[model samples]
Target: MKKEKLLMTPGPTMVPPAVLMAGGEPMIHHRTPEYSQLFRELNKNLKTIFQTQNPVLTFPAAGTGGLEAAVVNFFSPGDRVLCTSIGVFGDRVATIAKAFGLNVEKLTVPLGEAVDPRIIEEKLKEQNYKGVFVTHNETSTGAYNDIEAIGKITKNKDILLIVDAVSSLGGLDLKTDEWGVDVVITASQKALMAPPGLTFLSVSNKGWEAAQNSTSPKFYWDVIKARKAMEKPSPQNPYTPAVSLLRSVNKALELIIEEGLQEVFHRHSQLAKATRAAVEALGLKLFAAPQARSNVITSIKMPEGIDGEKVKKQMAEKYGVITAGGQEDLKGKILRIGHMGYVHEGDIIQTIAALEKALIDVGYPIEKAVGIKAALEVFN
Candidate 1:
């Protein structure tokens, strides 16, 4: 075998060995007292990762479901909400809001660019919207938006701020409450180093207040009912939870805490820098701007006349290094490399080496080990 298959996509990233082992442990009944104790402790650990004192509700859904929860629990039908989007995942927030009968106004920047907080501020000034939605890190384009600045604009004006931190939460730095973010949606799959079954949200006092006033119809994604369930004597979900995934997620969080959040952030930053340096060294341009680049993933533009999809296939099938291609309009135009969640410096080095081989195989000119050498410089 050339290599073991590695997950280098933005989500469903490579799960840590410890988390996988935790998942293999004997299952526990969801309603039992033992599960109650474990779930409660998991909730507390999640809060630490989220950096908020709010109730971090874990739902047995993907990150998009968490996005829907924000829409239904806070705004009423026909209520105007401004959505700031830079890429595919960012656009999903507005799509979900529209599905719930809310009037969605979008402020979109070109792909590979971050949403300007100033633009968001100006838009809010012109509208009487109930809330503003934005993604902290756009997985599709590898852009990281300025949540702190956007949060200031919304909170000071008393408008609800909803953030999708799915790709940013555990890998990058996010201060949910301090930034005045009323609602934050995240998933266990990306930076949390867990499987894809679990989604999480951090709801502030403002968010709960909106829940009380929300007239939008909601059932499984009901924040109020879920909170009530947690407030029960034993504390539980209204429905069956993904007990095994939760156990694995707790182990992942424990590993994160043991490494220290700051250290983890630094590690990702270093790896991300290395990736950018290596891509440039190979004569490829970066898709996202340097200032807006995310610590989670790196999007690289295919060299002129090079076939992006073919290169991606070669990497996965022959080299055993799985990566993601760009979405929608950018499909077959660029390639994405994820270094979030359980990624190491050596993993990055190997990925770059594989890309060098794949690029050559796809008829793009590149010197062997050129990217690896440049990446090592950044790591050192």
Candidate 2:
């Protein structure tokens, strides 16, 4: 079999060689003072990236685990929670809320659009809810909800604001404290550019209070236990962490700080712009509305009579490129081009070229070389 080419999918995306090395730098004991110091440093660096005065808790799980921690720790059975269902992850939030026996009310928009805060305000006025969940970047649809505005509406209200920022946390600007976000959850992959396994959650004082009231059954994901353990002078966890992954995470955060957050976001913006230009030049429609498109990923509508999955396969098998197909109800209706984390302008150009070939292979006609030309306008 041919060697698998580079990963240009949303995640686990391309890992920088340095971070990969860090992950492979010999496993260490999770209990020693050496590991404790490493954990402490990792926690401190995470706080800087999250821009939160509150503690940013780390776990040996994926982004979904972080979400579960937020739900199980802060909400009990019969707790009223409002979830926004705009895409796959949003629906996952609602599902988790239901599994925890919470009373869930989901406010939904179409796959490509964002939920309006005014609508949320109207719901808040009509009824009482203990918490609200919002996904900052809907990776499935490549739509980014306005969490800052949403938080503004929820401030001083009786609801806790939970955010799923897995794909957007480090790529985009998220000021957890200033935005009034009660709990912000993220993963080691995506913009963090680390291997999957580690999860991060920043909880506010209000979120902790909710946890005190919560009667949910949780041991592995118990925020209170993790918080207490983290506060120890040694800074170890109740459970063993993915030590190597955390090492990579520390280095990844270092890279983010070295480049500066603003410049990092700017790079993502330029790459997304170039990808959009290339796709539009090929006469493909974008799934996300202009205002709601995520800088991390761009979901494009599949042209009529084309198999989106076939395009993904062709790109991988034939062109040495990898791109993501749509999810859930959008399985064959769209294709997602991710430009987050380690994705640079050259990666965007190569993916566009592979996509053009795949499109033509699947019988969509387009002038040769036009897409790349349009994309170059952004790069040059």
Candidate 3:
């Protein structure tokens, strides 16, 4: 029988063997001492990883849940919030704010680019917005925004800074408190190296203050409640947590700690560079601008006559290499190559080779050996 294929998508990335094993461990009652220890350690380590002195809350939900929590628990009806929409995830921020009844002023830039800080500052000057929402890394177009610059721009405005760092968290350097971000949201599957189903958030004093006055109907995503429970001597949660997922997260965090954050960031940067080199060597164009490209996922424009979906399908079916096509309007226009989490040099080479073959099989004019050779040059 053929071995199972490797995943190279943006989220739900390949999990390390230790994390997979931890997830298979027998479940324990969430209220028991064993679970209490696990919860305590998870909470503590998440703070360290987030680089925040404040408490970081964990929920047994997806990254969307964390985004919802940030929206619902921080703002109320009729509140004005400024959001930047340069790609898919950035648009999600605007959408979530609208769904929560906030007056969303969306500042949009072209796809494959980042919103300008000058524009954000200009917008802040025009209106007294309650909060500013930005996605640190826009996964769809592989564009990475400079949250620190945005954070500084909002500092004097007295507006709250909420950042979506779901795909960028461990892959890039995101200093939460130091950057003056009031709320930093992340998920398990991206750069965190854990499986999906768990979302994490770090809330500063300013964010907690906003929560105290917010009138949104939120019981599950309440930061105050989660923080209160976490501070208790015996760990407890307001609901039945995802016990196995949390265990996996704990093990994942251990690997992160042992490898060190700087090393993790460097690894992702190297992989991203190698992937970009491969794309250029194949005579392909990258979707995102060089300055705004993300280290986790690389989006490449499809050759004029090649179908992006066909490339994804053929790569998976013939080479056992799983990749993703573009989202929404970008469908059949570009291909997304994810290099975050457990992806390594070998995985990168295999993906480049498979992509070369897929392009050739689909009648595109790619030289069969170009991509792999370029990738090997970077890896060596």
Candidate 4:
């Protein structure tokens, strides 16, 4: 029998039917009035998703490229920037800054733990930093940092707060304007429930001011040029845009708004809660602490004798439950399950059941249906 395929990874999550169909439609010419209307509306609607009044720039790039744009467009070379990291993606920010010839300082916590905002405050007090980079939700370790607190610390200062929200943008309660996030980076996939190809980011007034003062060399990744193009009466991209992907993102954003922002966030919260409950019920420990847990993806620590990679493979190849294994040193030590974007309660139920079956198949001792029962209780 052929098993059903499920996408349980943190990114490239399951796409909705409406969004898929939008991508299938015939491509519209970028210069047409119809496309210009769409291009402009997309910019406005993205502000709603980001909870910001600033223009949300759309680029034909991945989240990483958006991250790079945030760096090059806002800071000059040799500027002091602090990159606070809790996992792989956070570390990537420092690397990108170094590549741009910026003086990078990293405040990294242990894997599976969130970076403390107080520590960030202490570090800022000791040095004059041009900007502070932090991950809203660490994709690798499933840890959610306290960006709001960090934002509060950097708000009164001249420091710019840049957040990586690739995984948490739509699924989590990230208040971009209210939280004072100067710049936020996200992608079309992940919680946006659209296909990979487009990157979206918002910049506040402070972020724009920094960009004006920035002497960084930028051409294609130039936010100033992108914003100027958008400011025209008929909006257009400076380069040929990904028309189909942006079309898909329009439908996805509609779905998100129709569900209501608070409702969407609540759904992710419930799903994450159910997943954590199931993991604990199955006698497996979660890699992230409760206070630092991410609603987008849940990382579970592997049992002492079980191979996390093997379990991930069995869940996919044998049971049709696609899951992600840990990265780097944590590889073979943890397994991650995504609960973001277009996921329902039934998906959670089925995922927990599949996880149980995979565990038993991997020689891990577990009582049948215990995990599912706990998960159901949480959902109920």
Candidate 5:
């Protein structure tokens, strides 16, 4: 017999059994009325999740693909944009912008700290940027930016506010329309409780105007074409769509609505609090700043003289619990535990117990059951 490993990574989070069963259902033809009805309903539900009245476009790509579509559809080659980078995903926005020939300026903060909106406001005043790129929740460092404040800064201006809500949407509260966000991008695999393969973006009216003027070369990622197709008698994608993933997302959205969006957000907050408390109880330090901590993922600093990779490996092999390590510059120095989507108190408690044992097994001094006891206290 083999042990079932608990997936605690930032992405590809555990999928609910209902969603899995939905994805396993018989496939429907994309051009048929059946599929079109399902697609339309999915988009409608997604608008509720995004808190927007705009059209939410779906693509057969990962979260990165949604990010690229946002860049190419809203800005031309020489447009000036400000990318406020706090971690790896935030920096990726800048990298993608530069790759597309945009004159990118970065307002970067330390790895685990969120970027200050005041600095961004001052920078915006100094330059006439065409757009601003920001990550709503940076999973790399477990930092959450103040998108509402940033949106207020760019809302009345001629600048477009594009957000990477890849890991945050469905897990956190994002008021897309009220916050004046022009474009919001997210994927299915995170808090949406679906498999990876599809990315969704909602474009405001201002975002549509920017798209009409954008001269960037695009075919598969063309939003206008997608929107046109979606508006037709039988809604469909510009290219082949992930029908199975769509079915799964439809089910996932149903579950979210049943639970109520506010309740879902509250659940994530409680889970994060419990996870953080458990980590601290095990004598570990959280990586993200207190005020900027995210409810999606929790990144912990690797204790002195303890190998982060060893801890992760031990958690998987010995305890059947999987965790993620840091990326890029912070690699081997931090560990990330995801508590989004289908996660609950039991999952968090199990992961913390596994982590406590893993730390002790990897030569770190930690008392047994301390982490689980702390987590239980939070749950109680």
Candidate 6:
């Protein structure tokens, strides 16, 4: 029999049993009234999770597709936009914008640090930008930006405040409407407690008006087309949707709602705090800055002379605890532990114990059970 392993990656986190069972159910016709009713209910719950009163649009694609959609639908070629970067995902937004012939101005901060809203405020004063792109949580470095602060800076301006909440939404508190974010993009994986395949975005009235004038070439990612299909008496996607994934997401949303959003966010916060404490007790340093740390994922720096990949490998092979390595420039230098989406106290304890053992196996000197003890103290 195959050994059971805990998935602790930044995305594609472990799914709940109910969510898995929902995905296994038999498929239904997308155009049928039954499916339409399911779709409508799903959209309503999504708005609650997003904390927005606007219509949320769903697409049959990954998180990157949502990013591309935001870029293609909001501005035309030659339009000036500000893309803020703190890690890989932040830079990805700028890459997509540049690919579409937009004049991109990148405002980047050091790795493992969150973007300072004051810099954005100062930049806005220098140029009349069409949009400002921000990543609520940078998964690579485990840095969390303050969307509320940035929103306050851009709310009254003519610029659109676009946010990539792929890893933050549903896991953190995001006031989409209250924060004045013009466009919010997220995926089904991550904190949604569902399988990958579907991506969703909530667009404000300003976003829609901007779309009307956008000349960027697009068809499959057209939000207007999606909105039209959804506006019908029987709501549906512009194209054939991911019925199984949608079913799983519906069940996942139900679980989140049942748990209560604030309680869920608190659980994530406690889990992250426990994980951070465990890492510190194990003599391992965290990668992200303290004030900017993310609750969904914790990035830890490799111990002196220890290989991050080896630590990750030993954790999975010897202990059946799967974790992720860093991306781009930080690869093999950092180990990321994800504690979001259906994760709990027991899971954190188990992972900390496994990590302690794995660190010892990889030639790092550390007392056994220290990490677990630290984590337990947090829970107690």
Candidate 6 per-residue C-alpha lDDT over 1-380 given as tens digits, one digit per residue, 9 for 90 to 100: 98679998888989999999999988899999989999998999999999999999999899999999999999999999999999999899999999999999999999999999999999999999999999999999999999999999999999999999999889989999999999999999999989999999999999999999999999999999999999899998889999999999999999999999999999999999999999999889999998999999999999778888988999898889899988989988999999878899999998998889888888889999999999999989
Error of 4 at 231 (Å): 1.4
Residue 89 C-alpha lDDT in model 2: 95
Cα error of candidate 1 at position 134, Å: 0.3
lDDT accuracy of residue 79 in candidate 6: 99
For candidate 3, give the lDDT of residue 240: 88
For residues 133-175, write the lDDT of model 1, one tens digit per residue: 9899998899999889888888877689999999998898999
Task: Write the residue-wise lDDT of candidate 5 on 152-261 in tens digits.
Answer: 99999999999999999999999999999999999999999899999999999999999999999999899999999988877888888899999999999999999999
Indicate whether candidate 1 or candidate 6 has the larger lDDT: 6
**How do the predictions measure up, each by TM-score?**
0.98, 0.98, 0.98, 0.99, 0.99, 0.99
Q: What 10-residue stretch in candidate 1 is worst by lDDT?
A: 1-10
**Candidate 4: worst-modelled 10 consecutive residues by lDDT:** 1-10
Per-residue lDDT of 1-380 in model 3, one digit per residue for the tens?
A: 99779799888889999999999998799888999999989988898789899898899899999999999999998899998888888889899889989999999998899988999988888889999999998889989999889988976566899999998888889999888999999999988889999999999888898999999889899888988888889978888889999999889888988899898888898899999999999999999988999899999999887899999999999999898999999999999998888889999998998999999899988778798888888878
Residues 13-104, model 2: lDDT tens digits: 88898999989988899889989989998998999889899999998888999999989999999999999988899999999999989999
Ten consecutive residues with minimal summed lDDT in candidate 2?
1-10
Clashing pairs in 5: none
**Best candidate, lDDT-wise?**
6
lDDT of each: 0.91, 0.91, 0.90, 0.92, 0.93, 0.94
lDDT of 2 at 357: 93
User: How close to the true structure is residue 68 of candidate 4, measured as C-alpha lDDT?
Assistant: 95
Deviation from native of the Cα of residue 347 in model 2, angstroms: 0.4
Model 1 spans with C-alpha error above 4 angstroms: 1-3
TM-score of 5: 0.99
